[model samples]
Target: MLWLAFHFRALSLEVFSRGAAAPAPLVVVEKQGSRTWVIACNDAAEACGVHVGMAASAAQALADGLVVRRRDPSAERESLAGLAVWAGRFTPSVSLAPPDGLLLEISTCLSLHRGLGKLLKQARSGVTEMGYAATMACAPSSHGAWLLAKAEIEKAIREPARLGSLLAALPVALLDQPPAVVEGLERVGARTLGECLRLPRAGVARRFGQALIDELDRALGRVPETRAFFEPPASFERALELPAPVQAAEALLFAARRLLPELEGFLSLRQAGVQELELACRHERRDPTIVKLGFVKPTRDAGRMQLLLRETLGRTRLPAPVHTIVLRAPLVLPLSASSGDLFQARNGEADGDLLLERLRIRLGKDAVHGIESAADHRPERAWRPCQEQNHAAAAANRHRPLWLLPQPLPCHDGRLQLKSGPERIESGWWDGGDVARDYYVAEDRNGAQLWVYCDRVSGEWFVHGVFA
Candidate 1:
């Protein structure tokens, strides 16, 4: 199987933000024996003479206003697992390469994503979008891809035969061998894999142990390697903490965009779409501000979702600075692929649903609604407003006017010229409000058509509706 590997090079510092630029010169340090050493540093810190592997004390002395944070292995693992979930949109077979790497078996998925080149382009951009700096490489074997990515080679090796020659020059220290074996190999002038590979195989295996030989065989695609693949989570719920508190809606959206892509990936994997989303903005001392977004139909388009979210945020007023944001899409329904762009322009129809959704987000839920025909014969109780329109049935009478008046106005039929015969609507006797009328189509001198009905009981004529 063709394996693609992603080595998260800056994971030591990036777990805090993936790969977001820090506001100041920052470094992530870890304890090495009794002294703390910088495991990762940003360009800002590097410009101030602070580099990875430098002692924390020396790095602090070299840079002014430097921020030093301890490396969080737990966060790094969690971030890697989250990335595996995100990568599920590309390939189903994903395996975690612990500390800072991942392996994806993509032989069956290359054509599904167009090609290797296009797939790699999308993968690179996806990693960047998730705020991670990763080196990617492809090979015939999982360990081969992982080793190449760790060495920062960043090239796709198609043939298994070429893997040995390509991996030869890489440092022996890059291997997953024990420290003592690596030290022993280095002591014997075998600093690179090529040098160690040229040595007597039996002598090396007998001295260094068979595990190293087996590891080399795996990397070279000579032996089969079995790795547990990552299984995507059943539901999509993620939280991201900001580097600093943000009060503006735009800043909040900027952070929220990162989560949208992952949500899209999750939905894409499930072949479903989400109709609602809940965004919770966490504050230090106040309750989280919950912003609920809705759609006219289920959708998986990240771009469209972001557009509506931006419109919604414009009208929302945050009560306090938000320290963290959580995005949740608990329920997803099966959606046909053709329905993904259902809200888009169709048959030259205006984007009315989008307009309605935007208006509901801007105004209020109770302000904008649709109308449905109720089961009543009385003109006043014939229709009612509803949140969702029921298109199963329409008014039984086809001659009803599009525009109906709220209350019928009493008028004289002497000045009106009757056109159509009277249509009787004598139902609703079971209720207190009953209408016993014969509706007729009439025309005035202004050439406007009107709906006028004569009460059978009072013999009084009234204008009820106007035809558009």
Candidate 2:
């Protein structure tokens, strides 16, 4: 099993948000209840002889400045999910370690990311970018790295032998013992793992129960740690460096043209379509220009992507001549087979694969997009547009239309009659914004059919979707 060590990047700020007033200093106080308690206090809060975990009344008796909020279990969970998404850049096999930590299985990704040391730095960097600090450790087992990260375990990691020595220096606390077992061990003067290891194995197990011993075995690489792995999403990305700084859109797209084929090849191999892709064009003297492309569904076809890119690029201007270009496919999805004539049909469509390359040459890679379903289920959120080369499969889905109105428009009268449907779609409520919409297909007296919806609770009418 690939081991990962995770920590709460910052629990205090994330758990408790403060308003912009010169208020008292806030502190998180853990209590003996089923829930974790957060107490907001100041110098007066500190003077109450009250500390975190003290009884609420005790805290109030000490200082009147106490704002209490029950700990948000949901917030912690959401934080873990965000961490998992950020960690996806390192490895797809990311698991949530409750409270505030991520357990990523990076064994298979080590080689691809340059090695364990680089991978660790990369993981740390990924978390750091999200407005927090994090450290990562990798070992043969989860408990080993879990303890290492908690203890801020650092080693040169030049060789596996050095890693062993670092493990040996660890304290018994790193073993994650229960309160009673730890107290008993401390009473007996066993502070470090070395001391504990020197003791008789049978005696240690008998005294602490087999669980601690089993954990030790795993940490020492004796027993095995079994865990399920996550499958990486399918995606394709291409990058190119310009021969010379070129401000002309055509010149920039020329480099993109060459990179499209490789991206298509990667997508074809994965049997996936690009859901979304980002383009970064680096300038020698100015900030790199960034653009995004999206598709309606999963697609591997390159020609349609080319069309979209050409159209999008035609409207953009290069701020400066570019030196290098980068293409990133941050989202990808499974490719579905198209329902059509299986064999060579009477009319063969323009090879999407070839067209994407040519378009890259003309529009620059940053200008293309394919659309894919967003993870959310809201009518407006059900799909996300992505770069064409990346979400190739979604680009190939011919069912979706080309033009999209920013938001569905309200009908004349601001009140729409439910002509066809009360198709209620309810989704994404548990996580954050819950949607309950009663959908309908109505038409103006002029015979212009419109797709509309009304809020189930609010009874507010809105044009939600449309069919052309």
Candidate 3:
């Protein structure tokens, strides 16, 4: 089996920088005893001579305008787990490697992505799109891949025979052993893995304990590796807290874009489409403002959804500064297959549906509605307004006018010429409003077609609608 490992070098710093409005030196510091030390630093901080493990005060003294934030381990863990869930799009077998890494078993899925190169490219692109920097490596053994990724050695080793020699030259620190064991190896002139392996196995195991030997064996593919794979959630709902409050709704789009690909991946894995989505913006001291988006049909296209969301945000007014944003998809359905015609430029039904959705977004939901058949027999009560066209109901076997007048008008005596006709309708007696009419298709003085019906009880002729 082939294993792929991804190591997020500065996960905390990356997560912090994503919410920043401008590029500046930043470091994530953790309280160590009475002193604060840098656990992660961004590229700007590193360029300014601020490195990890340095005192926060010393780093601030070295660089001007340095931003130091307290390290949030919970947020880092959540981000890593979310990435692992998103990795399910590539393969079903994915496992988290604690604080800053992910392991994926991709041997079965390599062929589906055409080859290892394409698969690696797609994986790297996806990680970059999510606003994280990752170093990736692949090897036959899971531990071997993990070690390579942690060492920043980006190479693929498929041959089992090549694994031992490839990993031998790496530093002894790459092994999953305690710091004391690594120091002991370094003191014994075994700074490299090759040197450590050359020592007597019995003495090394006795000195460093058997766990270190087992880890080395696993790395060399001599021992079987076992790990629990991550399972994706049934529904998609993710939230991100901004580094600073955003006062405008338009500014929230940049932060929201970070989550769109994850949603696309979730939909792709399930082979489903979303019909509706909700974006909840959490304020500091007020109730969350919810922006709901409804689609004319189920869709999984991320670009289309983002465009519609852009239009929606343009017209939205923020009640308060947004500190956090949550994305939720409450309704998802199985995607249906559609085939296009060769003669037409585009599908008329699809274009119409998209247009209707755009109009609904620009105007309002209540302003746009379609017509559908009703159960009543009265000409005025035969149809009702609906948010969506009921195609099934429209297929009923009945003849009706294209345009119905709001109120019936009396027909002139000599202006009518009957064409076809005498369809009798008698109903609506339950509500004390009974209708007895004989409807017919007729022509007036001109060549215009009209739908005129006669009241049988009163013998009064009325023009109800026009065909055109």
Q: Clash pairs of candidate 3?
A: none
Model 3 C-alpha RMSD vs. true structure (Å) is 4.1
Worst 10 residues of 3 by lDDT: 336-345
lDDT preference between candidates 1 and 2, better one? 1
List lDDT for all candidates, in order.
Answer: 0.84, 0.60, 0.84
lDDT value, residue 303 of candidate 1: 78
Q: Output the worst ten-in-a-row residue range by lDDT, candidate 2.
A: 339-348
Give the C-alpha lDDT of model 1.
Answer: 0.84
**Ten consecutive residues with minimal summed lDDT in candidate 1?**
341-350
Q: Give the higher-lDDT candidate: 2 or 3.
A: 3
The TM-score-based order of candidates, best leading, equals 1, 3, 2
Q: Which digits, one per residue and each the tens of the lDDT, describe model 2 over residues 1-468?
A: 566777764544433332111234345555555644444333445665656666665665666555544555665564455455446556667676666666777678779879887877755554543334555676766666766776776432333455566777787775667889877776787887767777899998899888877877777667777655433334444444342456666655545544444445356446566756667888877888876666544555545555555555556677877767776777767664461222112244334434554565557666655677677656577677665443435343222233445886655465444567667789877878788887777765566556777778887776654557
Candidate 2 structure lDDT: 0.60
In candidate 3, how many Å is residue 106 off?
2.2
Which residue ranges in model 1 land beyond 4 Å of their true spot?
18-22, 61-64, 342-352, 378-380, 389-398, 401-403, 409-422, 440-468
* TM-score of every candidate: 0.87, 0.46, 0.83
Per-residue lDDT of candidate 1, residues 1-468 (tens digit): 899999998887876554233456888999989999998888888899888889999999999988788988887777787888788889878899898899999999999899999999999998877787899999999998999999999999898778889889899999999999999999999998889989999999999999989988899999999999987789888887676688888888878887787888788778888888988999999999888888766777777678888987777789999978888986688877565564345532226667777888878888998778887777778788876522445645656787899889998546898889689989877866777999999988888889999999999999999988
